[model samples]
Target: MDLISSRLLFRPMEERDRRFMRRFLSDGELTRWLPVDYPCPMEQVHLHVDRRLEHWDKHGFGTFVLEEREGEGPVGYCGLEHVTETPFIDLRYGLVQSAQGRGLAFEAAMRVVTYGFHGLQLPRIFGAAMPDNKASVAVLTKVGMRPDKRFDCYGSNLFTASVDRVAFDLKAQPVTHTGIYGAHG
Candidate 1:
């Protein structure tokens, strides 16, 4: 899949992205609010990438690597993951510390949400962020998602946000809700 924006590119996670993922996952500042999967070894990143790719092939959607337009480099990764035991799409995103606060996350997330609704034909999408993660909460809110619930996840406080099917359809005027596969579009 390839999603192009004015300043970012959302592309399928490739093998070469493992190294960047390793670094991104290991950074203390970047992973502070995220789940502690710290010190991600290269081998594990390789395996993780492989597994994500496999899931994408089987399910037609998985987390994708977010890079800059024109090869500026990978800044982050974002995508919809199945919420265990629930019929929901959990939106996840993580970015390099250096890339924070430039509106990239919001732009990338908006595009990804568009894909989830239109491309994947999903009825709803949700995201969770640690209460302290003001930045992420802002991104979700900017995309028209609303706080639905608050609960503990991964042993920490979490905030859940969502855009229901009807609400999603009503939120974006120019953007249609009809499904459109990214790979083909």
Candidate 2:
């Protein structure tokens, strides 16, 4: 899906975006909170991009690369991903060092949450951040998600939270809620 949110543009990830992905993943500082290994290699970044494409084909929704409306290239990626074997759409977002300030991550994440609720008719969307990652935790909180639990994955701790369409509608503009898929909480 293609979308413009506030100051950011959201579009699907193409193979050519591997370089952008690699750039973002290469920064240990930016990729620290991710529940993955450090120093993500370029080859691994390509594989991740491939998985993102596959996710879009199978689920009709997946990661979208984000860029500033006035800017030229990818600043980060924000969207939902299926965590492991779970049937849950785990909200996720990440930005390069260049896009760290100006609240772009929050803007991009809010857009993704809105798409999941009103665009994709998702009943609920979940997200998690390492409690130590203050930046990520702040983004999740600012997007109207609240901590629900703590769990271990990949031998790391993650604080998980969720927000549903009903809550999203009540918090965001009411007109944005569309129950095309029957309401569920």
TM values, all candidates: 0.83, 0.87
Candidate 1 lDDT, 59-172, residue by residue in tens: 788888987766678889988877545676778888887778888787677678877887778888888877788898888887778977632344445777789666866665
Judged by whole-model lDDT over C-alpha atoms, candidate 2 comes out at 0.77
Residue pairs that clash (backbone atoms under 3 angstroms), model 1: none
Highest-lDDT candidate: 2
Q: Which portions of model 2 show Cα errors greater than 4 Å?
A: 150-156, 174-185
Poorest 10 consecutive residues by lDDT, candidate 1 = 176-185
Model 2: colliding residue pairs:
none
